[model samples]
Target chain A: MHEMGIAQQLVQIAIDSIPRDIENPKVEKLNLRIGRLASVVEHSLTFCFEIITKDTPLENARLDIDVVPVTVHCKSCDNGWEVTGPVFKCPFCEDGDVEMLTGREIEITSLELADELKI
Target chain B: MEINIQKKVLEANDTEADINRTFFKDQNVFVLNMMSSPGSGKTQILCKTLAKLMPHVRVGVIVGDICTTNDADRLKVTGAKVTQINTDQFGGDCHLAANLIIESAKQLGCEDLDLLIVENIGNLVCPAEFDIGEDARAVVLSVTEGEDKPLKYPLMFRVADVAILNKIDLLPYLDFDAKLVVDNMKQVHPHLPVFEFSAKTEEGLEPWLDWLKIKVFEKTGK
Candidate 1:
């Protein structure tokens, strides 16, 4: 699946971000923010990450994905609301002309490392 | 030390996609990324569409599949240059990436081409997630696939510039409601241009062909 490709990218990003001066740095956890509409299955991504990072520096890195809810802004009502499920119409005015405000991001927010670089 | 690395994991892919976009621009080639589930008649639609445009424009194709040159072989009959990317070599990726497109374009020879179409691997969910550096993304939805697909796969419908409701000729024999499907797609993306047609009967391809020809002309000024 394409999750493998995404997992490979995530693993590469984590490994590349490690400090060069730090010796034998280990990634502890990775904080990932994925929007609800990103179409990524978390378990599949985690499984792929685990398998792909086996021989790499991110072997021990635990992927923590935070799923953001889909949000839409109603132009007629000038209000925005988070969609709980497949409801796309504006909750207040029942407007179908609402614009999507969020829920499409797939990014890494931060990462935790075992050893801190000394100042 | 909590070194803040607020970077996107897929940044590398995005950067590669931008480079491909620039190349398409410089070459004056309009790239259309066609995405759909398996058996949605994407290849048939391309065959019919390319046959109509080949006399006017130079079209090249880069088709991706897990392990088949079947699509390429079929599309070759249209007299367009076709290159196949078997993802089986790359661990059977379900979707085409920008890097893969770049390599396949080189294989297909993008020079002197007015339009390039990347037929993405058949899938509704995974292919929607990747941006493969296309000037326009079109989602092909068949009548038999159910009208609720747009709701279930919101991301795919939302990101598409146009959607083709294929197999319009089958509507007479089946209980599928074209209006309901169009309404459902509107719920996801109210402004998404949808063209309802059947590639088999060539029932409603004029609007799609005209739109595409105009787009190619807009890009190449030819």
Candidate 2:
């Protein structure tokens, strides 16, 4: 699954983003912001995470995912709304010329680490 | 202590992709990433496209598959420099990542070519998720696949800048509504450019080739 590649990246980013001063850091939670348009299966990503993070700094890390919905802003009418279904027209002005505001993100917002460190 | 580090999960990939993009920009090579199902006639269409694009535009190809250089072999007939990346060695990746593209481009020598087309691994879902440093993304949907194919896998068409409906020569034999398929794709991506072609009969290729030429010119200014 491609999620395996993404999961590997997530774990790598988590480890890389962590401060080096945190001695013998133990990961407790991983906060992820995944948009609806990313097409990543949450369960599949979590499963891959479990395997890839086995011996890494992210081992046993609890994943907290926040799914972001597809939101669009109408360029012509200056209206914005969340897309509920396949329809992409602006709700207020019914304009089809719209720009996607969000919903394609796959970001790691934060990492929670245990306070009990070796230092 | 909880660390409030906000960063993109695929930042590493994005960085590599940006570097590749700059490399292409400096080299003046327009890269197209083509995605589709296993038997969607992607190689055949590329053969036809290369036949038309070559002699005027120097074209190169990097094809990704789970195993074998079969597609690369087929594309060799067009005389374009073809590089085959067998993902089986690397755990059989379903899509070509940016790092892989960078490696392949180095091998293919992108500096000498005007256009470098990446024939991605034949899968709709996986390839859509990864950006392989391509200037444009094209997804081939054959008539044999079904009109509702876009409905089932919206992300592929949603991300595609262009959608090519191949195998139109068999349209007279099959009970497929081409209009509905186009409509379905438009539903997902309102402004997405859709091209219909029959690689067997060589019909409806001019627009596609012209579009590619325009893209190449836009990138290379040559």
Candidate 3:
């Protein structure tokens, strides 16, 4: 699935962003903010991440993910509400023209690396 | 040491994409990144398009798929220079990233080409997120896939410069509301170009081909 590709990209990003001073810093944790509308399977991403990070700096890293819900702003009613399900219609005006404010994000927010700089 | 790396994962890909954009500009080539779901008839449309434009323009293709060279083989029959990249050999990639595309384009000798059509792996969501330095992005949607596709996959619709509703010939057999699909797409990307055409019977392809020619000529001054 696409999750595997995204996982690979995340690992690459982590590897590339490592500070030069940290001599093979052991990655402890990786946090990602994924949205429901991104159509990514979080379990699949985690599974793929584990496989992709093997023997790398992130081998033992814990993958943390936050599932973000889609929020829509109704243009007609000027109302803001969370998309309560797969249905994207506005609750107030029953309008589908609501603009999407959030969701559709697939970002790696932060990484926790072993403090090799102190040693 | 917990170092904070607030970097976008796709930054590397974007850097490669910038290189591709500059390369295309220098060569005066118009590139189109075609995206769609599996079984959306992307290759078929390419076949028809190549047939129509072969006489008027020089066209080349770089086809990406998870496995198999089936689409490339099909396009080769159209007498266009074609290159195939089976991303499975790399990592079973669902979408073609900019670095991979640039590598493939170089292998295909795209510098001499006027237009490069990149048939991205047939997955709507992932491919829409990646920018491959194409002059235009075309999202192909067939009538059998239902009308709510635009609403369900808004990112693809919103990112695409053109939405080609393929397989209009099957409209009589299927209960697909073409108008509803257009309306939904317009809601997301107002003023987006929508084209209804059938690759099988060669119906409604003239306007699309014409628009494509105009775009290529405008971009390349050819």
Candidate 4:
């Protein structure tokens, strides 16, 4: 799965983000925002993260996932709604010409250092 | 301590994709990313496309697969410059990322090419997730596949500029509803163009060929 690749990239970013002054920094948690349409499975990603971070500074880090909902706006009728299903048409206007406003994010929003960035 | 990163996990891929896009733009090369499920006749349609476009258009191909070069080998028979990327090192990468596209393009040398077609590794889910700096994205859905594939894999259809319903000749023999599949795709992605054709029989492929030729001419003036 591509989660392994994401995990590898995440670990690399986390390790590189450690403070230069800190002797040793441990990441306690990785805050991630994954859209509903994103191809990542939460548990699969965490599993890969654990294995990849085993010998790295993020060994103890756990992923905190936020599943973002798909949101779209109707370009014709200007109707907007949060899409919960596969169909993306506007409920009011039934127009398929809608613009997506959100729900495609796969980002690392923040990271929690092990209590004040201490060793 | 909290460190705010606010970075895309695949930022590296995105960055590379932008670079690839710029290169294609500067080189005036039209790139198409073809994605679909396995056995959907992507390779078949591509073979037909190359047969039709070669000599008229200097087409280059970058074919992706896990370990085999079978698709690439078939495509090379058309006299187009073809390069294959075997993703065995990445544990059989399910999709082709932007960096891999650029690597293949460089290997083939992007100059003197009017169009570059990327045969993304089959699998509707993963390939749609990765953007390979293409001018157009086409998803080929065979009628033999379940009619509910559009609903099941919305991302793949939603991101596609065009949908190719391959194997239209088999429609009479099978219970597959071309109308219903088109409707389903419309539901997932509004205004997405669907070209129903059989790559095997070469029926109804002209419109798709015209679309590709138009895109290439629009970009490369070829």
lDDT of 1 by residue, B48-122 (tens): 999999968899999999997999999999999999999888888888888899988977888879999999999
- Stretches of candidate 3 off by over 4 Å are A16-25, A35-39, A55-57, A66-105, A114-119
User: Model 3: which residue pairs collide?
Assistant: A114-B1, A115-B1
Q: Please, what are the lDDT tens digits per residue for candidate 1 over residues A54-118?
A: 87767878888888888888888898888877657666776456888879888887778876566
Which structure among the candidates has the greatest lDDT? 4
What would the DockQ be for model 3?
A: 0.35
Report model 1's chain A TM-score: 0.89
* Poorest lDDT segment (10 consecutive residues) of candidate 1 chain A: A87-96
Order of models, best lDDT first = 4, 2, 1, 3
**Deviating ranges (above 4 Å) for candidate 4:** A116-119
Ranking by TM-score: 4, 2, 1, 3
Give the DockQ (C-alpha) for candidate 2: 0.67
Q: Which stretches of candidate 1 lie over 4 Å from their true place?
A: A74-78, A87-98, A115-119
Better of 1 and 3 by TM-score: 1
Which structure among the candidates has the greatest TM-score? 4
Question: How large is the interface RMSD of each prediction?
Answer: 1.9, 1.8, 4.0, 1.1
Worst 10 residues of 4 chain B by lDDT: B213-222
Tell me which of candidates 2 and 4 scores higher on lDDT: 4
Lowest lDDT 10-mer window, candidate 1 chain B? B1-10
